[model samples]
Target: VTFLCLPPVSFLLLPHALALWACTRSCPSRCTCTQEKSCSVLCDRINMADLPKEFPCEASSINLDKNNLKFLSERAFGTLPSLKSLSLDHNNISFITPGAFKGLPNLVELKMAHNEYIRYLHTRTFTSLKRLVRLDLSDCNLFSMPDRIFIEQTALKELLCFQNNFRRVPGAIRGMENLTHVYLERNRIEAVAYNSLLGLTSLKYLNLQENRINVIHDEAFKDLQQLENFYLNDNLLAELPKQAFKGLSRLKMLNLGGNLLTNVSKTWFSDLVELEVLYLDRNQLCFIEEGAFENLTSLITLHLNSNNLTALPFSVFQPIYFIGRLYLFRNPWECDCSLEWLKEWMENYKLVRDIPCASPSSVAGLDLSEVVYARLNGTCVDPAELNLTTALPDNPTTENKFNILISKLLQQELKEDLVNSTESFRNGTLLDPAESQVSGGYNGFSTGRALLVLLSMYLIQAETGPH
Candidate 1:
């Protein structure tokens, strides 16, 4: 071996060169990189407080979910033009600066959901993502959207903003020309104002379910000419004006369940000519006008369960020639001679179940559908003699007014009776004396009579059930 002594400067330089090699090799910290020949990174649930400085250069999809990110700066995603999908869900992000996603020109899908602190927004935060297609901001605690958060996003097709505090539909989305799906469900939206959905001609799916909506203007959906599925269920709507759903001629599925509706007036479904599946369950509906569903000839399934309906005129469902499924359970159905026509109509469909009757204690819980009309002891009126038409004149006659007044008076009396009985039972004041009449102040009626009235009143509440 030949003697080969290096200079003193080489020893000091050797340590510095070794330090540089370790720095370059430590770029994949706090994240797992997995790609055979392509570039992609998944940095999920690593408790990252900030974006990794040395991410994959040519990465396309970056998943940084379940982190503790508080803010997304403009330079968060550094100059990655090939990035296509980025998911930053379950973060505590409260703010996003302008051009936050400026470097991601080719980004297609961006999901920032479950960020409970991201309530307020700036208009230009997402303006740089022109090529983005699907954007999900669900469960963000947002009260309202910015004026132009989605400006110039012509290629955007879907925008999901569900489970927020939005009081109404975001007006900024009216400019998007090619969007096909928009989900705003489980918000605090109060009403659907006219022109709120205007300029969304290409919108096919619009879901506004589980909101606080109490009103829907007749022209609210006028601009959605191409809309197909409309979900307005689980809202606070009490009553809707005639033709409240106009201009959605192409609408197919309509969900108005879980509302406070009390009546279905004529022409209610007159505009939904091509409607197929209609859900009106879990409401307080008691009356439905004739021809209410005459225009829904293309309907396939109809759900009217969990309501307060007494009797539905056959004319209401007469035009629905090809219904596939019809659910009428959990209602206070008055199964009398009035349901004779329904017996024949129900047999036409095989999916119909045994409907339960809530009236006529003799057949109270019995299945009205399975009742053998031929073997029954009761004499049913002739089908032609049983008039099913119920006139609802705007200007009722004096006699009609008197009848209404009497009906209200009777309801008040029944209410008072129930209250008195409940109070007597609660206070233990109910009579227990074995009394004999012919005295100065004889006990009114017998104990048996009192017990009978109380039993009947209690049954009424049990039959109606809870709201």
Candidate 2:
């Protein structure tokens, strides 16, 4: 209380200004430093040759994207003890030492995507980040991943690695117990191992669309019991194995458009009772089996455009009465009389949206709603319509005359056979043309017409007897 010596007001402010200057000096070069009472380092277009040794990011996040950062020290994030999020994306980072992220245990999100040169990643790089939730390495020019890249981060939920050149999904993701979503679309994946996703029980959505998956081994998705949306569009899938979607009891939407499927079997998708939307456009399918969608009673929307189909299987859509929309355009639909049933069913159900034609060969000027399938029921006209009758060289008569003469001979033979055989034409038990007044009954074609033809043929044969 007795010592009250004051140097000056400016002398007290000088030390505060010096402390702020020290925070700025510790930040890396080519980065903007913001200071209020705390310091934050924001780097834009910065050359990340090395991490600043004295950088003090104990109270703020850091942005270090779009740089020519080639390498990082083993403990590059050692000084950022309180950094919440770190962005080192779109850089030329090719190599990282064994322990790149040695510190910064509080990091929540890390974005290192779209870096063409950052092809390699070490497994233990994120070992110290216990609280890391979202890890995005998308579009990073990565061809493969270490098996145990995320084995230590059991708390990770979302992993986004889409738009990359991965030959297969990382094999080490089997230990992610709490993982929810995995996005790996637009890659070059050919095969997916069954045990590759062994431990992801809580996974909900998996997007493997726009890939080069030529084959889907049986039980490829055996462990993904909770998966909902599975997209496999724009691939080279020619056929689906029976067990392809075996364990996906909750799948909702499936897009199989733009593939090379020729035939679809009922058993291939019989277990997906909860499927709603199915896209089958732009394929080579010609015939859809009758019971293909029998078990999928919950289906609402079905797309079948741009295919090689001539006819829909009989009773294919009869069981799926709950469907709302069906797309059948741009297909070679055979619009014959057999389509009468389809037209009637369509009219009954009022399914008019899926009635467009892709070409003139099927429905050129006729309206699908106005036209009835009964008009196209008959086959081509009979060959008798053409005058191409030939005379048997041995018999020397036209087929029509020969047929009549053969009929008379058959009648005479029948009469002789009845007389010689135990069965007699005299009894009422026999079929007799004389006793029956009903023409065309069990005896002949037309009532009087067939009798006259047979009688005239017999008269001619009687006039020219043995010859």
Candidate 3:
């Protein structure tokens, strides 16, 4: 009796359930809909060159992607008042006229990606959708666009111009005030002109990572005060100007890896106060001046692996209060008493791994982490020269003169020890420029070291002259 009564009620509800499904699935011919609320035409490879004559006017999202439509004319969307999204991805569209989407005032998202032929667009093509938030125009092979194409997209937050044929930072992004993330990687951008990024004050993430960027003007990043993450790796950047990163005070992660940067200037990182991670790996870095990282109070991780650093100044790491992870692998570290200060500092430091020595063949493959100060002190030990057994002078003035002589001798030895160490890479053995180019690594460095040793030794000898 219960089953029989349930069927009667079920039969009555079958039409209502069908109606609900029909609201999204009742698509017009050559198209599908989910009960008329959303619809998609099965236009992929169907050779349907034109849009279906009728689209559900009340549908919120209509997927017209993968169609063979070639061009978009004025009023092409025919006053779509309720159409909030339209996808034309993978289509063969070539051009868009002014007022092409004349009536899409409430539209929020428009995806026109993968349309390789859609290169030409009028400045007013997107003028109808003032409420547009996300626009994906990537992979369109567009060489250029009118500067004002995105002037009205004030609320746009994400603009993907990735893998396009842009010659530089597109003029369209200059005015998109609310943008927070911009991906312009792998474009043909060669230079970052001054004030090119001026209007994007609200941007937080900028990736110019894989372009032909060789020059960055001093004022290139002056307006990006709020920018946090910046990626500038894999470019032709040879040198960074002093004011290149002038206004990016809030940047956290700066990736300068994979370039031809030879020196780390003291002023390079003076402004990045909130920075935590800095990547200077995979570069041709040869020298880092003392006090280079003194201002980076918040830096926790620094990567200097795979560089040409042979000896680091003992006091260079003094300014950093906390460094949890430091990578100095693959560099030629000359192990000797020159490392005495570093050994003492490392004992107190947290990380004790991956630091290897590349010099003094006996310890070539040894990890510097295991070596102690006692072992390092052995190589630089010198015999005491002052003979304490000698009779003291009876004159008080004579005694004071003897003490002064000993002081100068000790100071001279200390200076000579530092200059003699191969850690400085100044082995005055430098060959002629032509020959040094052929014998660069060890021979060229040894030549420079020889010259520095001669000059420093002369100075030391003069200080203890005729003692």
TM agreement with the true structure for every prediction: 0.74, 0.69, 0.71
Q: Tens digits of per-residue lDDT for model 2 on 135-227? A: 888888888888877767778888888888888877867768788889899889886776767878888888888888888877878878888
- Taken over the whole model, the C-alpha lDDT of each candidate is 0.76, 0.71, 0.72
- Candidate 2 wrongly placed segments (more than 4 Å): 1-41, 45-56, 338-354, 358-362, 365-367, 370-467
- Leading candidate by TM-score: 1
Per-candidate count of clashing residue pairs (backbone under 3 Å) = 0, 3, 26
Best by lDDT: 1
Considering lDDT, which of the candidate structures 1 and 3 is the better prediction for this target? 1
Candidate 1's residue-wise lDDT over 1-467, tens digit each?
Answer: 11143223465575444333333343458776555434567788989998877666667678889999998888678887777899999999999998788888889999999999997888888867889999999999899987677776889999999999999888978757688999999999999888678788899999999999998887787778889999999999998867787777899999999999988877678888899999999999898888788888789999999999888777666777788988999999877667767777777656677689776554676777655442112355321111222322455544553454344344444455475663223244433323323221344344444554565555555556766
Tell me the tens digit of each residue's lDDT in model 3 across 323-436: 778888888886655765676667777564576876555456666655432211134321123221122244324334435444444444444546665232235532343554
Candidate 1 lDDT trough over 10 residues, lowest sum: 382-391
lDDT of 2: 0.71
Q: After aligning candidate 3 to the native by TM-score, how far in Å is the CA of 150 from where it should be? A: 1.5
RMSD of each: 14.4, 14.9, 12.4
Worst 10 residues of 2 by lDDT: 380-389
